[model samples]
Target: MRKLLFFVIIFGFSSSIQAQKYSKEVLDSMYSITQQTKLELTKPKSIKLMAVGDIMMGTNFPNDSYLPPEGKGPFDNVNVILTQADILFGNLEGTLTDEGENAKRCSDPSKCYSFRSPESYGKYLEETGFDVMSIANNHIGDFGAIGIKNTSKTLEKHNIAYAGIFAQPSTIFEKNGITYGFCAFAPNKDCIKIHNLTNAKKIVEELKQKADIVIVSFHGGAEGLKHTHVTRKTERFYGEDRGNVYKFAHTMIDAGADVIIGHGPHVSRAFEVYKNKFIAYSLGNFCTYSRFNLDGIKGYAPIAEIEIDLDGNFMKGKLHSAKQIDEVYPFIDEKKRALKEIKKLTQEDFPESKLIFDEDGSFTQQKE
Candidate 1:
């Protein structure tokens, strides 16, 4: 009975929508309207968004051993769920530079982890259904400015929208009839600073004015298995300030961000629904091959699928549990470890929050 119910929910929610394309005149007219008028005039439609954590699909710059086979094996296990969404997003943990001088200095090579994937890997991301990627993480500058430029160029060549690099701090794109604005922030150098609350809020507000839905991604917070729970305060790691992720997320939501996705902590954290917006504290290491530590909790993550109304209000979501085994490709976890862990963390951290998750991984808000 329980299994049947789960399938029913999945099938019922997996809607196939064909967005009506508007002419340039219609789009311009829509943009010119006031917020209240726009909301009243817009037709409500369900928009599905899939978000995952850090993705460093095997880097071969330092060595060839880390590279995967010459095929689409990296995302084969998870591509089904990925392609189902209208928009798919994830944090690009490292640069996609084939050749460049590494900029990061490490005292101990054994402990340091820097990634640089081949430029050809950008197509693989597109094939795996990644429409937009966040390039604002500590390792994004592993190969310096050259790497950053190459990463942006490569993604653009593959028709993927990217943000949080160079002067392109935010990207606004339209799919179907819904306009989405995406921006990324991190505490690392050469990206939008997550610590600057005033600046962050201002950017989100500006994005809100242009797009119907604004989604913000941040790579901040302490890392490792020990950092599974959100402290709701400022966090620091290795003498570097990781920013107050709680305040940052809430502020972004208040500034008109419909969704907030966080990743940096290599472990999964809690989920919260603030002011009808959904926020995932940390989605953990979605797919970090070779160099990443994948022991215990570090390997657990969820391919989060979220559905929101045209007005950017949270509707429902599901967590498809996945885990990396032996630092290789990610596979669905039979035990649903990621889902269970998030449930526990959400209960402990936001006890009074309206978001409710069932054992089957489907989530909804409590009735008023």
Candidate 2:
């Protein structure tokens, strides 16, 4: 009888430990230690994610951001930080294929915007560590469906995957051998060309079934300014109002999305933890060289990294921000010390940000 009681006690203790393992607080604490972030990843462990927002490679493209025979872009400057993650992501704010019907160019340079990039250069995205890109943005239809088709084709040709819009396959996060499904919604209306209402719900539901975790991206909200804070109310664009981003993002979360990454407001917004998930309201511009936006305080882009368990529940996360310095027509900036400085300001912007400033004013990712 004593032997059986001992066995029961052991089993009960093991079950308790495992149950405590997944509590939201404990998982978040463990993720703080994984920011050194590596690929090939650890098993039954958390996965590190890196993301850039609004990759607007326009007429002012930088050499580092674009590959040869593609364009001159500075995307390579952040390659180290970006490539070190398990899978990297970004918002492809411009179409990648040249075959699409060109968007009607806005005449006002101050308000002008239309985006395209050569398809051949997609190899750079693969080489530079971008495993997935989101196509649900205003520019997805800039070249029309032909352009969207060409962009999807080029991404597939390069073996670089995408999600959110076009004829793209649902992307996933593969960590600890678990596949996580990805989907997105854009107010751009073009998302319907690829993901209709029925299909969008279907994909989200399917992701819940097939993925260890599900991440949803959405491009909805008014453009420009730090006033992009999302509420539980509808928003307007070009005089047409749309669903509340807060409601939409959380709705998808309830429907099985483990995380939510939102963009399109050319400015960054405060993030929150909802339903045991992390939601970055916006990350703004990462490698974009647009001479147009004068965000001033809001244009600085965040290099967001999140850690999640095999089932894609939020563990912990951090943001490494970078600023777009010049406002020139052809814009580009070296990211050498900029990363350090940008991180400093981010700590100011987000009091809860992991970065800590020393008494002497230096910043480090970990407080220890």
lDDT of 1 by residue, 192-239 (tens): 999999988988999999998899999999998788888989999999
lDDT of 2 by residue, 64-137 (tens): 23322334545655665676788677888887775654566655533445666777557667777777788887
Summed backbone clashes in each candidate are: 0, 12
Predicted structure 1, TM vs. truth = 0.87
| Cα RMSDs, all models | 15.5, 12.4
lDDT on C-alpha atoms for all candidate structures: 0.87, 0.65
Off by over 4 Å in 1: 1-44, 107-111
